[model samples]
Target: MNILPSYRYQMADHKKSILIFYVVIVGLSLIFGFSTTLIINGNDAAVHGSTSGNEMATVIFLFVVGLCTFKETFLISLQNGVSRKTLFTAKLLTMLSVAVIMAMIDKIFFLLYAAALSITNSQVTASTFYEALYPSSTAGAGPLMLHAESFFFEVLLALAAMAAGYFITIMFYRLSKTGKVIVGAGVPVLFLMAIPWADQYFLNGKITIALVKLILTAVNTPSHMAVTCLLAIVVFNALAFTLMRKAVVKQ
Candidate 1:
C-alpha cells in the first residue's frame, strides 16, 4: 500500500475545513484592516493605524487543526485496512503539508492587507504573528529572507503542536476510565502545586520575572528555539507512534 495516495486522500478530505478556516481568517483580516483604515482616516490627530488579530486567529486555527486531526483519522484509517506504520507516516506527511500551506496562506493575507491599505491610501502598521512574537533589532536581511524564516519557524511550531495533540489523543484513547480520571485530576493538581513551589522557592517569588526572561530568551534566539521545537516534535511524534503501534481499533 502506497502512503502518498493515502496522504493525499486524507488531505483532500479536510479541504472543506481548511477552506472554511481560510475564509474566516480572510474575513477577520478584512474587518480589522478596513476598520483601522477608516478610523485613522477620520481622526484629526496623526494616529497610526494598526491592524492586529490575525496572529491570534492563526494560532487558534493551528491548535484546533492539530487537536482534531489525529484520533478520527487513526480509527478510520485503521478500519480501512491500513497498517499502523503507514497510517503514522501518512498522518505526519499530512500534518507537514497542512502546516506549510497554512503558513503560506498567512503570509499571503499579510501581503494582501498591506496592498489593501496602500490602495486606500492608509498608513497602517501591519505585523505578522512571527514579527510580534520574535521582534529583532538588527536587520540587514531582505524581506523575502525574513518571510522565509518566519514561515519555517511557524511550520515547526505547527508541527510541534500537532504532534503533541496527536499524542494526547492517543493517550486518551488508550487509557482506562480510572486512568483518565487520575490523569485529569492529577495534572492540574501537579501544576497548581508546582507553580507556587517554583515561584516561592526557585524563582524568589517572581514568577513574572521568570516568565519575562523565558519569553525574552525565546524571542532573542528564534532560530535556536525553532531547532529545539523541531527536536521536541520528533520526540513527541515518536512516542505517539509507539503508543499507536499497540492501539486496537474500537468497534
Candidate 2:
C-alpha cells in the first residue's frame, strides 16, 4: 500500500479526538471564566477571559493517542503486506505533521485567549508554562521572536511526547502477557515507590534534586528545549523501529 494512505489514515484517526479535545478545553475554560465572573462580580459575567497552558493537555492527549493507535494499525498493515519500514516512516511523517498542526493550533488559541483576556477582567493575569518556567529568558525579545519560540517549544515537546508514546506501544506489543504485566506494574513501582524511597532515604533526595536541576538546566531557553526534545524524539523513534522489527502479529 502507498505510504500516503497510511499517513492520511493515521492523521484521520487523530482528527476526531483532537476536535473533541479542543471543544472540551475551550468549553470548560469558558464555563470557568463565566462562572467565576458571575460569582465574584455579582451577575456581571459577560465573556470573562482566563489563561493557562492548554498545550500541556495537548501533549498528554497526543501521548495517549500514540499509546492507543499502534496495535490495530500495526496488525492491519502487516496483514495487508505493508513492510515495517513503510509503517514506521508513515508514522514518523504523521507524528511530524500532527505536531506542526497542533503547534499552530495551540499558538493560535493562545493568542486569541490572550486577546480575549485583555478585553475582560484584569484581576487575574495571563501566563504560560514556559513563561512561568523561564521568566527572564524572552522578556526582551520581539513579538515575532517570542511567538516563534513558543511555537517551536510546542512543536518539539509535543513531537517528543508522541514519539515516546509510540515507543511504549511498540515495546508493549513485543512483550509477552506476563512481561506486559511486569512492565506495567514495575514502571509505576519504580517511579512511585522505589525511586521515591531511594531518593528520600538512600540518596537523601539528592537524586530528586539532581533530576530537577537537570531538567531545569536543559530547558532554560527555547533553543535548549528544542535540542533536548529533538534528542528524545530521535532516541524514542530509533528504539521503536528496533522493537517493531521484532514485533509479531498476535492472535
Candidate 3:
C-alpha cells in the first residue's frame, strides 16, 4: 500500500505540537540568558562557564509526543483502511523526518545561544546533550565535527525516546483495564519503591551499582551511546509492531 497518506498524517499530527514546544523553549532560553546577563552586570559575582543541560528537554518533549501519537493515529489509520504494516512504516518515516528536523533546529538554536551569550557577555555556557554525554571526545573536536556528532547523536537519541514512548502507549493499549491498573501502579512501585528498597536493604546497593556501572561502561562515548540508542529504537519499535499487528480498534 502507498504509505504517503499515513506518513503525511503522522507528520501533520506532530507539526503543531513541535512548533509550540520549540517556540516556548526558545523564548524561555532567551529570557533566561538575558536575565542572567542582567543579574551578572548588576552584581559582583565572578562565576564563569556555568553549564546548562537544557537541551535534554527535547528528549522529554519527544517522549511525550510519542505517548500521544499512537492511539488517535492508529484508530484513524484503521478507519482509513491502512494496514498495520503501512501504518508502522509511516510511523518510522515520521519519526526519522521529525528527528532530523528537530536535530537541525537544535543545532541552529545552539548557534543562536552562543551568539546570545557572546553579545550579552553571559557566563552561562550553552552545550548539547551529546557534548555532555561525551565530553572527552568533544573536548578536542573542531566545531564542524562537534556539530555533526551532536546532530547525529541527538537524532538517534530522539528516535529512541519516541520509540520507547510509543512502545509504552501501545503496551497500555493492549492491556485490559485491570492490567492497565496493575502496570500503571506496579511499574512505578517496582521501580521507585520495591526495587530501590530491596536494592538498598536486601541487596546492599549491588543492583543499583551494577546497573550504573554497566550503563556507564557500555555508554562511555557518543558512538557507544549511539549504538545503545539504535538498539533501543529497534527493540522498542519491533515490540510496538508486534502489539499493533493484533491491535483491535476501539472507541
Give the per-residue lDDT digits (tens) of candidate 3, residues 101-188: 9888888888877877878766677777777767888999998988888888888889999999999999999999999999999999
- How many pairs of residues collide in model 2? 0
Compared with the true structure, the alpha-carbon lDDT of candidate 3 equals: 0.87
Tens-digit lDDT track for model 1 on 1-251?
78986798779867998899888777776777777778888899988866642645655666677667766777778778888899888888898888888778777877877776778778787766676666663255578877787778778887887788778778878888899898978888876887878788987879867777876776467776787677879998998998999998764
Where does candidate 1 stray beyond 4 Å?
Answer: 52-56, 197-219
Best by lDDT: 3
Model 2: per-residue lDDT, tens digit, 1-251? 68987888788888898899899988987787666655655645554333566778889998998898899898888888898899999999999999899888878877876776668744444566566656788688787877787777888889999999999988998999999999999999999999999889888899899999999888877777888999999999999999999888896
lDDT of 2 at 171: 94
Query: Which stretch of 10 consecutive residues in model 2 shows the poorest summed lDDT?
Result: 43-52
TM-scores vs. true structure, each candidate:
0.87, 0.88, 0.94
All candidates' lDDT scores?
A: 0.77, 0.83, 0.87
Candidate achieving higher lDDT, 2 or 3: 3
In model 3, which runs have C-alpha deviations exceeding 4 angstroms?
Answer: 49-54
- The most accurate candidate by TM-score is 3
The C-alpha RMSD of each candidate to the native structure, in angstroms, is 2.6, 3.1, 1.6
